[model samples]
Target: MQAEDSTTLEATLADGRRMTLSLPATDAPWAADGLRALRPVPPTHTGRGEEPPTLPEQPALPLEVAILGFGL
Candidate 1:
């Protein structure tokens, strides 16, 4: 794999799949966010037509604690 430029990258996978990615810029944080956005979401349930067991809900947190936790 090699970067063609600040906004372009080229690579050939093990299975001979050639890839080229051209981005708006070379910012690492933006690239990471883009990669994370491209990832597929996993299914919530197993494929066996059965729902996963749900856990009992806990009591809600105090408003101040919830706000602090969101910062972290």
Candidate 2:
């Protein structure tokens, strides 16, 4: 599936059918929401007996130094 242009979008179904749509500016938000709804949800993790992975600890930064660095 791919967006053809600013006003056009297209997709190829698993059964080999090609689908296309001509979108008007007013319906852009609806089109966006429709696309989002079509996305597949990821499977949840079910660790039977395995231990959860641990991330390495990161060094903490000084609060004043971090604040001063933000704008730069």
Candidate 3:
């Protein structure tokens, strides 16, 4: 199973019982006290307009490297 959130990545476990790590639920993941203690900050905002910022565009990569190394 994969946990969906700010990023996407696959997870693997060796044995069913040996998988002991626990993760915060995406739903109600942050508690008031936890968030307050963490004092998390958002990325600095930029732009003059009220519209949301678009994701940064990526450049094309070398064909061989992309295919062999990344399988992209």
Clashes of each: 0, 0, 0
Model 3, span 11-69: residue lDDT tens? 45434532222334344545433222332245486557587889899888878867888
- Positional deviation of residue 43's Cα in model 1 after best superposition, in angstroms: 19
Candidate 1 accuracy as lDDT: 0.66
Error of 2 at 44 (Å): 15
Give the alpha-carbon lDDT of every model: 0.66, 0.65, 0.46
How far in Å is the alpha carbon of 54 misplaced in model 2?
A: 57
Candidate 1 TM-score, C-alpha based: 0.35
lDDT of 2 by residue, 1-72 (tens): 676455666777767998887655555555665433444345486458777899999999889889988875
At residue 38, candidate 1 shows an lDDT of: 49
Q: Which stretches of candidate 2 lie over 4 Å from their true place?
A: 27-72
Each candidate's TM vs. the true structure? 0.35, 0.34, 0.21
Q: Per-residue error at 7 for model 3, in Å?
A: 40
**Segments of candidate 1 deviating more than 4 angstroms:** 26-72
Badly placed stretches (over 4 Å) of model 3 are 1-52, 69-72
Clashing pairs in 2: none
